[model samples]
Target: MRRKIYTKEQILRAAYEVVATEGFAGFTARNIAKRMGISTQPIYLEFKNMEDLKNELLDLIFSKLKNEIFPVPHTGDKVIDLGLNYINFAKQHHNLYLALYVDEEGGGKKMHDFSFNYFSTLIENDPQYEGLSREQIQTLHTGTWVVVTGLASLASSGSINPTQEQIISLIQRTINNIIAVNETVN
Candidate 1:
């Protein structure tokens, strides 16, 4: 009889699968072990504890998400398109999205910071945003992300299924409102 060998990479992959399907709340040694048809012992042996495995999973998820939303192609409307991309990502990766955003163990600060920079880059590249001051741009960027994240959370949870046009309209309205307020203060 041949002994079944499971490598750390295999375990991590399986763990991600488990999380992707079941969410952070459902994540457990038993679930991962069952996914791989192996004993829970290997999971513990691979990491110090569940937290360690979860941290690794978070890294993997964050990397994948960063790739999905960053360096966003020129869609003629970077801000609106980025919001649509975020919502679509959440809808597709609902469980993973919940883990990233809704789970008690939060790692969303990294995503938040990355979002600020991502929005900043979009603003910098676009000639339309060139007239805005740095502070105004930053305010607009942050406000638009609030819309994106909230819309994503709703979409991810199946609370709403807004069409792309609707999403783009909403984002445009948000950006415009922020600009208006910035002008009012100026």
Candidate 2:
């Protein structure tokens, strides 16, 4: 019997769904093939190895983040909404988010850089920060990214047990502190 040709995109999509739903451990050629109703040979044909497929999945996750989570407007408070959205994404897509940021090497670095770029862009474009120096704006952006990422990671991992409201409050306090310090120095 002739084997049906499978596109790489099809394989990646199936693999992503499997990883998202079943965690990284569930990402195997056999499992993906089972899900796709095909044999593992197609996957091997498309990807050099499991690691290559996993890296592509990670890249897809980052693409999703860029499209979905990172475009949130600053709304006069850079930290609050951004942090809320970040935590919400993690909680809502626990397995996928964990796989994207936790289970893979270099995942954290990608997330950190993506987050920093998002925050920096927001700060640079906001009219409220018109008079702030570039260094100050960069500092604020980095501080906000750290606080939000830390809180989101903790919340997602169950390391911090707090209601969403409480988490938001803590984030607000951190942002307020940063603003206060910036004010005093300026």
Q: Mark the regions of model 1 whose C-alpha exceeds 4 Å error after superposition.
A: 1-3, 69-74, 106-108, 117-138
TM-score of each: 0.78, 0.74
Candidate 1, residue 27: CA error in Å? Answer: 1.9
Give per-residue CA lDDT, model 1, range 1-186, as digits (tens). Answer: 997778888989998888778777678899999999989988888899998887787777666765766446545677777777778878888877777777775456765675676678778888888888889988987798789889999888888888877888899999999998998999
lDDT of all predictions, in order shown? Answer: 0.80, 0.76
Candidate 2 residues lying further than 4 Å off, grouped into runs, are 72-78, 104-106, 130-138, 157-165, 183-186
Query: What is the clash count of model 2?
Result: 0
Cα deviation at 38, candidate 1, in Å, is: 1.5
Question: What TM-score quantifies how close candidate 2 is to the native fold?
Answer: 0.74
Clash-forming residue pairs, model 2: none
| Per-residue lDDT value at 133 in model 2 | 76
Candidate 2 lDDT over residue span 1-186, tens digit each = 995789999999998889888877788999999999999999998899998987887778767776778556544465576777777787778887776667754356766676667766766777865676777767777776677667778877888867867867877777678778988988
lDDT of 2: 0.76
lDDT of 1: 0.80
As a whole number from 0 to 100, the lDDT of residue 120 in candidate 1 is: 81
